[model samples]
Structures are given as C-alpha cells and as structure tokens.
Target: MLSAIREIGRLVVEQVINPAQSSGGKIITIVLDEANAALQEVGIEDFDPEKANRYLHTDRGSKGNAPAPFAPLTEAKKTLNKIRTWLSGCEKVIPKTAADCDLVNTINRALGLDDPILKAVDAAAGLLQKKDRKFLTVKLEGGKTFLGDYEVFRKAVAYFADRKAEKSCSTGCACSICGKIQEKVSARTLVYGFDTDDKPGFIAGGFDKTQNWRNIPVCSECRTFLTQGRKFIDSRLNFKFYGLNHCLIPQLLVGNADVLEDIINILSDSHKSVSLRHRIKRRLTDDENEILEFLSGSKDNMTLNFLFLQKSKSAERITLLIEDVFPSRIRAIFEARDHVDSVFSETYNFGKIRTFFSKSDPEKRSNDLNKYFLEIVDAVFRGKWIDFSFLTRFHMDVIRRGLVKDEYFAFRVGSVNLTV
Candidate 1:
C-alpha cells in the first residue's frame, strides 16, 4: 500500500507538475567547489580563519594538526554562480509586464499613509530580521506570550512605537537596508517547570540551559505573588508574569530597539513597509487574529510553539503511588531514590537537627489506654512491611481495591503515604 502511494505521488509530480528549470544541483556543485577556488577571489593564502583573526604583524601560536589554508576564490565564484542561477530562475517565474504594475500597487498602497511614513514603517520592519546569529533565549512575557514568535517581536517594536511627533526610538536591533531590516534572536526561551535544578529542593529547578529552559517552575510563595499584575517589568528589564499552562513566565532581555530601528531604516530602503493600520492593529490588542497576522508576515526568521502538559501533578501522583508501600518496591524505583537521598541528607546533618527525638521531658510518656491499639495498629502496618516483595504485592492489591471506590481516593498505606 505504501509503494502504491509513492507511485501515485511520483506520477503526479511527473505529469501535473511542470519541472521548472532548477539550478539546485549546480548550487550544490558550486558549494562543493568553493574550497578549492577561494584564493583567486579573496586574495588570501587560504581561508584559514584563525590566521585571519590575527592583526597585522601579530605573533601567532602554532597548534598541532594545522588545517590547510582556504582558497577564497572558490567561495566568490560560488556566490556569483548561486546569484546568477537564482536570478535566472526568478525572472522566469516573475511577470515582466507593466500590466502587472497595478496589481502590485494594490498591495503597495496602504490607504492613507504616504511614502515617507511607509519608509519609516519599512525601517521598523527591518529591525526584527535576526542576523549574524546563533542561539537566543527570550523569557516569556505576557504581552508577547501570545505572540510565540521572535519574528513578530522584531517587527512590532523595531519601528516607531509612538506615532506622536515627540516619540523616540527605544532598543536598537536595526536595519542596514533602509527598508525595515528587522531581525530577532531566533533562540527559544521558556520557563521550564524544572528542566534541570542542580539543587533539589521544595519546588522544581531553574531553567536547564541544555534543555533550552522550556517550562514554568514555581514555588508556593512565587505562585501566590502572581495576582498583582498582568505583566511587570523590573529595573533589570526582565519581564516576569504568568504564561500558558498556568506557569510563571521566564525573563527575556530585549535588545536596543532604537539602534535596531535606525539600522533597519537604513538597510531596508528597497523593501516595502507594513501599513500603519497593521501597526495600530498590532499595538491595540492582544487578540489571536492580530497576533497571528503580525507573525504571519515575518519571513520565517523565528517561530515558536507552546505545548501544554501536566507534569508536576503527574509526577506527584506517580511519586505517591511508588511510595505507597514502606520503602516502596516499584522495581523501577525513583521516589525511593529521593527518599534515600532525603534520609542521607538528614543523617549527615544529624548534629544540626536533634529535635524530632528531643522532647522537653527527659523520659517519654504514653497513656496506658493508647498502648492497647498501638501495637495492633503497628502489627497491621508491619505485617505488610516485613518482606519487600510481599509488601509490594500487598500494596498493589490494596491500591486496586481502594481505587475501585474513586480514582484519586486511596484508603490505606503501610507508610501512611495515602493522599486522601
């Protein structure tokens, strides 16, 4: 059946799809040839970036297994070939007739805004285009939480935030193009529930950089502090707020919008501007439609998606179930590990914690009436704990019977670990 589907797909591509001229193969070939030809085009002995890193007449240290110098000529030829091939193909696909001008202008005309305002708009747009970039981590913000895209962030704030005459530029992620040369850091930032907390404590951990800090981790106190504002900015410009999945927001530091706008306006002269209507629309609401439209226009520089999962609650239930039996016998023990760690920590700091067994009275006192049921209760709980295997099986049995009453309700436990 899979073979039949592939056969049909191939047939459609071969028949219905006209094979337009493509220099894809040539592009790959040129890329492959770039290393050999670099010297002729670039005027360097080789593209040894390390050697290039040195200033004029600077001393350099020699490392073992020095790589061969790169030839820059190959790279230049490769770029020229790529552009030529691309433009050739583009001309075929794009209409050359003046008859198409009105159709193009229809998209160009933003009802009331003039070319000057449009240029400013275009400049603002250019700021979001992330350039010379690697990884970026943005803390989740309430205003931008719904945005879920860096591309949108670049465009929305890159241009003038205030149209009122006295309004000024803010952060500087700008354009070199004069057309809006928008750029945004493409790195994903998140408030992970506890992606990696090196220190194990009451709540979860701080963001795990290795894991890209993706979830919301909150303590009991921090969770309670969320009611004060929709979004709050601290002196550090770090935004803290609630995000999706009822999680606390991560802190994202923004770039300089003022410089970013200046550069974008300069670099983005050739590019068209996003409309004032669009700008006003973006600034006015936090609705999904407007947010999506803003992101949709961004040229795929950054994309973000949020997934919802009930991790803490799930982990809690799993932990409780595993701790049901005394010293738990889940075979794949986890909470037992945490329990062992806890006990070790307690014993290690024994000198620091001598309170549990330290009652004010030198000798302990118990009522004679309590002595009767105490032993019986101990016996009942102890009978299940005498053997690990028997205890595990017994724990599972009691849980099954108790769960029949209600999924979350558990009646008995040898270790008194029952939630209900």
Candidate 2:
C-alpha cells in the first residue's frame, strides 16, 4: 500500500511538474518587483526589500473587530517565519535585483517591528472582508499572487524532507509497505482542506498507540512521497459531484495523462451543467464521447481506479468506495450502457434509466447507489447477466406509495418496461 501511494505521488509529480520544467521555465522564482510594489502600495517606507520566492500560503482574518489577535494571525505569523527562514538560507541563489533587495529589507523591517506584522495581517484581513474574497494570499513580484501553487510549496516540503531524513529512528524495523529495514518510521498525514476542524487523516498510521506510525513502519522517503502525492491528488485529480461534499478521485495507470485529464474535465463540466431539478443525468454527452473514445482506443494495457470519499462526522475524510477496472472493462461497461439505452430509447426515450438511477440527496444515497452501480457495471463488463430485482422492488414501492407524481410515474413505468 505504501508503495502504491509512493508510485501515485511520483506519477502526479511527473505529470504535473516535468512538463513545466521541460518548457524552459523555472518551477518558481522570486518576484521581487511585484512584492515591492505590493508593499509600497500598503504604504511601507524606507525598508530594504528582500527577494522572496513566489509560493502559496494561506492567511485569514482576525476574529471579530476585537483588538485581541486570533488564530489566523498566529497562522500568518508562522507562515511568514517559515518563508523568511527559507529565504535567509538561500541568500546565495537569490537575485541581487533592486526589487529583491527591497523585498528582503521590507521583510526584515516587518519582523523587527513589534506590531507591523499584525498591522499587515489586519489590513489583508480587512481587504478580504470588504472585498468578499475567499483568500488572503500575498501578492508577489510580476503581479502574480501566491495562490497555493503546489510546485512552489513542494520546494519547502523538500527542505523539510531532508531534515526529517536526518532524524534518528527510534526503532530499526522492516517497513510494512517497502520491506526495507529502517529506523524511524513516520505517520503520513493527508490534508485535504484548510479548516482547523478538518482532521488530517493518516494514510499509513493513526492516532491510536497500538496502530501507531511506528507499527506501520514506513520509511521517511516513502512517507514524504505519500504526502506530496496526496497534495497533488487533492489539487488536480479531485472533483465534486453536484453540491455534495463528497469527492471523486480518479487514479490511472497505463494511460495517457492528457486522456485522464480530459476524462476529469468532462466529469467536472458535467457536474457544472447539472439541472436545477435535482435530477442526476447518467448519459454521456457528445463531447464526453470523443474523449471516451480516445481513452478507449488506448486501452491495450491501461488500468483505471476510482476512490469515492466523504467527510465523516469527525470531519475526517474516509473512502466510501473504491473501483479498480481495466480499460477493456470500461469499454465493456460503455457497450452495456449503450445496449440498455437502445432497449429503452423508443418507449421512454431512456427516461426510465435516469429514474432507476436517480439520487435526489447524494449524501444519503451515494454509498448504496455507488456500490450497486459499480456492481452492475462490473457484471456487464464481465459478460454476465445483470440482476434487476432490486430495481423492480424499488419501482413497485414508489408506485405503491404514490411517492412520485405523474411525470415520475411515467418514468417509473417506462423503467419497468425496460426491466421486462
């Protein structure tokens, strides 16, 4: 499992970062001019500016209008301190441009002041509140804001990874995932969001002493890989279905990155086009077909996996379902769907299919529907007959209770005809 997570991370990094580097662009650079301009706009004076790397970090408002500081202020300070440390350590590589010097001076000045950092934090917070902005990200050189760019953040993480590797291991034991004997296994935390209440769930180990990180014994390298991989997945491969809080993460092996991206794009676009009527549309659009065909054509040795996750009551993310299927299986599933569509295309115009799969409240219906839906898709892909008993019973109950009005009744009737 640790190997799989690490492999996923590697794939993500390759797909995301390699192309940027190949294009002759630096992964991240200090935008001295922009940072100086922003600081000047905020009315700071006479401080020699420091060149700072453009990186993503979060800041939030102080609590109410009270004079006392809040958690967001503390978080902002920590983030600034981290950036300052990183910058100070990399003085050799930092450009000696005028803007860079000014940025460094400004940072030093701010740090020296007892209340300037607080003032800046409050000013940014005020902008967020007055402008109704979602983020309080700092502006940097080149008019670009630090919007939490993963590539930039990865460098910081790499620095920490080196430090972590240097730590002495408490117990030298064989890693559970890699089978290598190593000292000092660490827990891997997968962070999905920024809320303080959002629990950082462990991928390899948990809070329980019996199931501690040491017990799982993942080496620091693997642990770092897992962290980076989760960050990439959360940023790029994750999508929400409708308004539900659940996320669908697609993992692909043996397929083109462009094709996988297209598939995810279709899913995201379809999600945005969902009707206001709360009806779930299962049919693929014309645009979706082109990409699917491209995906299907490259299925010689391709494998695809999906994870359906939702937040638990404790605000921790948990996988609700998982599906691992080959490209051939996906093609088979598409064929089966077409067959079903043909059977009902004339009488009900395939309306019954939607009715059979309708999910009004995703939170309540997702697990059962996702499980059974995948089961049916698998059965069809495997060239086996699908069981319609569950659908039949559900239709009968809806009719018996007259739970659906005329339009829905028509759909139920049309769906029943397809079952026969």
Compared with the true structure, the alpha-carbon lDDT of candidate 2 equals: 0.42
Clash counts for the predictions, in order: 60, 12
Model 1: what TM-score?
Answer: 0.14
**TM values, all candidates:** 0.14, 0.55
lDDT of 2 by residue, 1-420 (tens): 335446556554455332111111111112324433324332211111111122322111122221111112234455455445544543433456665455555644544442555465555555443323222223344434442332423343444444433332345777666678886554323223222211335322354433445534567666655655555445444544322223234455655666555544444343432431133333332121123333444454445444445555435443443445566765665676668668667432223443454453434645344444445434544556766686676567656545544434665566677654
Q: On a 0 to 1 TM-score scale, where does candidate 2 land against the true structure?
A: 0.55
Model 2, C-alpha of 240: deviation from truth (Å): 4.9
lDDT of each: 0.24, 0.42
